[model samples]
Target: MKTEKGFSIADLKMNNRLVLAPMAAISDLPFRLLCRKQGASLCYTEMINAEAVARNNKSAFRLAESHPDDQPLGLQLFGARVESMEAAAKKLAGTEKFDFFDLNMGCPDGRVLRQGAGAALLRRETRACELVKAIKEAGKPVTVKVRLNPNVLNSIRVCKALEKAGVDCITVHGRTVKQKYSGPVDFVSIKRITKAVSIPVIANGNIRSRKDVKITLEKTGAAAVMIGRGAIGNPGIFADLQGHLAIKPINAMFNYLKLFEEFGMDKFGRKKTQVIRFLTKVKKQQVIELVQKAGTEEELEQALAELK
Candidate 1:
């Protein structure tokens, strides 16, 4: 599956076809890098607030960080206002060297609904179409990330507009906004969208195992499958997709703890011993008891010292 032309997002040839879904608060630099090492063809930053980008927020800017190894990364942005989104895309295009700009149209958070972003954009076809057009104008590949809206009878209409508007690829989550993360994912909708669009369609939802990935791709006839929540405490799924082998969840936890620590968890004014104590999930009551007996940070250090 390797391409000599290097990796890309749209017309772009990636090292592999597997991609990590842009999850909020989960797909940070360390997590994406870990997945990449595990054989993820490509990975994206967490879905960032488009309005934050337009306003030049430092936290949002930090989300865009990538290393040399994190090639062909997708930068996902979200917002309701087309103008703001366009400006943010243009700004990102000018500075950040991303393989593609992904529009977030699938988030179901209440705050996102309040701002008319995420799944809310799905209902406003005219506006969503315009945003896609603007992203296309940015000279890079335009990808839209969406979920199946429960009330959307015109799903085909929306897909057609996205295609006609020049979106290079579309990633469809199987669940609707109303359904949130509940129930089974509607793979049928994904199949319908796949048949309707000419470009690559990615199927995402409840993909926890290699078996699920295999079945999903076959059932939906999608070009790729995007893994999200399933990869949080488990990254071996990437390795499994590569046909290597599946490791135990304990092994995954060992790796995640190292990753979390190296990525600055220990820098919270605590020594290594104190940090590892919290990381250990022996029992909630035991942790509370340890914290309760400590009169100060020094006492906490002594208590942890005795345990070790």
Candidate 2:
């Protein structure tokens, strides 16, 4: 299904090249719906711990919750154990909700690294491949997201191995583990990977606007672009990138609040954090302070209305 507007990975098809990265404590069901409502073609759940999911952790399962409208969703899994990864994939697949599984081989979080997962897996390509193979046994299209290797361009070999191991797609973040989220993205390395791989290569890192997406796609020749921190405050970035009208962050936040209630998500902590992200761009510091101190959603909503 290669076309001007869409592409296919195995049986899953995406109508556009915009995807929301699986962010910790961020990419929830409501967040996915808002992004998709605007224009994101594919969305992933917040990174779920494979070991936690395998152990049937209620909190981990809650993070993977989705609605019928949240179509073409990918449940992101991160951990080092092949047995745990397999069990987690099987457990989620039995629910018949997720469209695919995204293996998190790119996370630079020290906590994950300490557990022998994330970018650390890049150092263990054999184990990463083994984890992918075990996840594949659960019978779903699997994708791996990774950073540029410690040696940079060496990431090509990692993607190549994952591809040979039957991964449906690979996403290259274009930054080494050492750089984390601070340095410039290596588009040259991403471009080289696109040239080296036969499957779709998604270019990620520092893409925040439509212009940024265009430049990344042109420079890397990637099939799509994944937005990470950029989409946190503005889910409308997807619509803007897709040639639609630019959506105001405040407006999108209101929509998020609506969805928040519609979906019955009661976690005030998650709600407050999302509100703060959506309004972080607002120049009024007092408003953010008020938002932070607001004891209830109503108080927060009233405070946000002041921005309008």
Q: Using lDDT as the measure, which candidate wins?
A: 2
Predicted candidate 2 versus true structure: per-residue lDDT over 95-157, tens digit per residue: 749888999998888899999999899999999999999999999989999999867456888
Candidate 1: which stretches are off by over 4 Å? 1-9, 151-153, 246-308
Give the lDDT of residue 302 in candidate 2: 87
lDDT of 1 at 235: 60
- Where's the lowest-lDDT run of ten residues in candidate 2? 1-10
Model 1 Cα lDDT, one tens digit per residue, 160-185: 79889888889999988888887898
Would you list the clashing residue pairs of candidate 2? none
TM-scores vs. true structure, each candidate: 0.81, 0.94
TM-score, cand. 2: 0.94
